[model samples]
Target chain A: MIRLLAKPVSAVWLLLMLATGLSWWLGLDQGMSSDQQSDYRYISSGLIIIAFIKVRIVIRYFMEVREAPLALKLICDAWLVLVSSAIIYLYCLGPVPVATGG
Target chain B: MTSADCFSAVERKVEIKPHVPGEVGVWVFILGDMLIFGLFFIVFVYYRGLNVELYSHSQATLNQNYGAINTLFLLASSWFVAMAVDDMRNKTVKLAPVFFPLAMLCGLGFGVVKIIEYREKISAGITITSNDFYMYYYIFTGLHFLHVLIGMGVLVFLWRRARFAATQADVRDGAVIEKDMVLIESGASYWHMVDLLWIVLFPLLYLLK
Candidate 1:
């Protein structure tokens, strides 16, 4: 089993699975009593980060983006990080403040 | 032209191979698809920002276990596809038949689990119209599920095509092996993209706080 996962491609699949489990546990923990419960930015950010990591692995290994040219690789890597980071940023911002029309 | 000159031209083409997966056109499509999905994700987060409490409450109702199961199957399917591609690259064409079907079966497992999850939600009086979060959940996941279905079709095509690689005819028809491989690689690439979408979707819908 260990040897199977040692292969670069298989290692990515194992890592992705482990990351899913870790994020599931993170989601289950509310981290505070009911009286003090609130949106946990730390947890949300962690989840988004895990998502980006998993996406990159999928693109690089499963999609064979690594075997492709550098251009495709950069496009994929950038898309994964940019969108997930944006999601996390907005998630941490609480609520969008509505602007009033003049 | 002399035979030596023709051979040299072929060698040059090999030396200067165009670096793209499956086909250059498919990569263009993949990038465009990712861009569209990225836009939707950004829009979702923006809306989520306006109604955090409602979104959070609805998110709490999601079954993380089902999402995790889907993730496992999708990843397994992708791994099998990758292995198939590797076998093809190594010229072990005989293995393509085994790997492609395994990949498809994993994909089938994911689809079954997703359908069951949707059924559970529907039977419990939850649905796309139930709330804002559920709406996004159904829309995104429903679209993803549709992609998986289409990907399964492509996998079936790949499986049928890969079978030729092992037959006696491929020994005579070299082009048959090459053509089938290109199709398999292209289909596998699309399947991986489906897995990538679900990778982000799982955390966004089920696991994130």
Candidate 2:
């Protein structure tokens, strides 16, 4: 029923709001101080992972991938795992240089 | 007269077939589209690694509040479309219009927020040409926004059809149901993809300090 679905949708919105608020609060508390680089990196990484997990839930359940064929579902699941791992790994390793410095 | 009438009624009854086969082609197309986006994602990561400082600097300038809000909007919209698809399957045509617009409105709401964000950023002199960070910021978010717009268009298309088909009788209703479900499912898939991409984009563009 429409009423039933509306509840979950609102709940997800609330969770996202909390996550955003948390990110904003943390970001501001860290201030514009350039000395807090390490703190910023850890906080940003954590937020990214949390957001990733939330998106996965939306895709898997609300998108009805559970009803999709086995192969398609496998592909979808694998894609998320692979992409998330890759991003986290790359983030951990730090950025590459654009070119050789003079 | 009664026996003859019963036999004729049985002979005239039409059989219905499942619409799953036609859906396969569309799914394949969507998968291919996902792969293309996947490649772009990989490239984004590669570049971000090479220019982490610049990218992080660019990200710091992004509005985390807007990014988070848009993420919620897309997530909520995706859920509504899922319900719409479910309602279509259960023969609840009356509910389609309500959920369909709710989904599209969320998508539209995202676009409106994005436009305001873009205007503010541009006024702040942080255009694409501002630096490498701004370049990636614009490219990634702009592409995502374009997909969100397309997803909204798809929902609007389906919503219109559902409205037009609502007045018809049971005989014509079957085809309408099949068409409506197909449209909704396809739109939902695209909408989910939009949400999924944002999940990645949000952290990459906003949270990456």
Candidate 3:
């Protein structure tokens, strides 16, 4: 049992759990009842960024991609950057007005 | 061997070979799956961007607790599988078989919570057709649930394999044969992919502000 916990994956698992908790807490509405419109773009962006970081950790550790060849590692990192940036860009762009009276 | 000794032994064994954990084809499939899901995420966010108010309001109705709990379940399941893989590599097949079942139990826990969440939403008349958000919710989660089901079967198969390895007295050091390592790693990687996708999906659908 000690040996199991001694493995680096155990540390990775602990980090993943704590990161999940952080995301969960960040997702909660923190009792901001002001009538003024609040900009949550930054918070939402942070949330997604954290999510992607967690995904990278899982890929590198749980998926054992850390030990993989350079090509595989590059591909995975490329996907992470591409998707994460796209989502954040679109999210921060805010709502586009719908075309009506077609 | 003591835990410290085991740790150093692992450290010393690390070679310069560029090791892929699973077979090449398995990674091809895993990467393909990830690419599709990445597109799914982009599509969802694109639509959500067109009407942030609608998505946020719909997201408000979702029970964050259920999402959080399910995230924990899958994370724990992945950890168990990782440990199991390590055990097999380290020639500790006796304890490895035990981890697979525990991992499956966590997977089962995810399914149950998901069902309950679905029940709650359905009881409240929030079906997929109710809104765009719920539509994506059902489709994404339903698809992921299918992956979980398949992963459960994979875990069962791995457990059987581990058990067989344990029973083989002729096998030196209780380690799985080299030929079987590829298959084991492949299945394990697939399971981890399921968990990885959920880590993103949870926040995108349930917690995105």
Candidate 4:
């Protein structure tokens, strides 16, 4: 396993899996009653962070953007940062942060 | 073109910047796709912000295990695709032919799993009309599912081309290999985008609170 993780790609994959687990843990309170759960923003921030890390990993390692020219890498990296920030900002704009379905 | 060879030659002599992967056009498409999906993410979050309770309650009704399994499927497939690219880079062209198909199989498996999950949801009378959250869930996952199908099509094309290139590599010069390398790189990049979208979607739709 250590030998496997030595590869940058494999390391990214492992981190992605671990991040997935973290997100899962963050939402495990789904099974608990209402009082047991923390607020959405608190849990979602962690999820968004992991989401950012995972996207960067996929772009850098899997997509081979790490070895690419500066311009290409910058564009992809910018997308990773900005879009996630926008989502988080939108998600935090209001108190309830979600609307009921019609 | 001896682009790959030229890069190596330049590296052996002087230090210059490496070239972009594949064609610039493909990267343009990837960028466009990212913007489109980014818009979707913003829109989903915007809607979710309006009524957190309904969204959270509807989210709870989802089966996290299904989403988790689908995520594993995509991640495993991505590893396979990455390995295929690595195999080609190492001049182990034969290995790419094998790995590419394995990656496709994994992608196909994800579709199968997603279909099953969709069926279960529909049978439970949960659907786009079920709730505000369900509407977004179906729309987002449905659009993503469409991308997966398109990706698989692209993968098939790449597999065929790469396999042919491998055979040509046995007889032709290294340029053949380099030509196919860029193609493989481009296709794999697109496929990774699909996986990347799911990475965020899984947590937001299924795992996060």
- Model 2 Cα displacement at B181 (Å)? 1.9
Q: List the residue pairs that clash in candidate 2.
A: A95-B49, A96-B49, A96-B50
What are the per-residue Cα lDDT tens digits for candidate 1 across B114-202? 88888888999998899888999999988889889999998888777767665733354344565555666788899999998888888
Provide TM-scores for the models.
0.86, 0.79, 0.91, 0.87
What is the Cα root-mean-square deviation between model 1 and the actual structure?
Answer: 6.3
Question: Which candidate number has the best lDDT?
Answer: 3
Clashes of 1: 0
**Candidate whose TM-score is highest:** 3
Q: Cα miss at B140, model 1 (Å)?
A: 0.6
True contacts kept of each: 0.82, 0.41, 0.92, 0.65
DockQ of each: 0.59, 0.31, 0.76, 0.57
Winner of 2 and 3 under TM-score? 3
- All candidates' lDDT scores? 0.77, 0.69, 0.86, 0.79
Of the true interface contacts, the fraction found in model 1 is 0.82
Show where candidate 3 strays beyond 4 Å: A35-39, A96-102, B1-16, B169-176
lDDT of 2 by residue, A1-102 (tens): 446636655566567557656765665535555454556567756866776676666655666566566777787778777766777677667643222232
Best by DockQ: 3
Off by over 4 Å in 1: A1-6, A34-39, A95-102, B1-18, B168-175
User: Model 1: how far is B24 from its true place, Å?
Assistant: 1.7
- Candidate 4 chain B least-lDDT 10 residues: B8-17
User: What stretches of model 4 exceed 4 Å from their correct place?
Assistant: A1-6, A30-36, A96-102, B1-17
> Model 2 — TM-score against the truth?
0.79
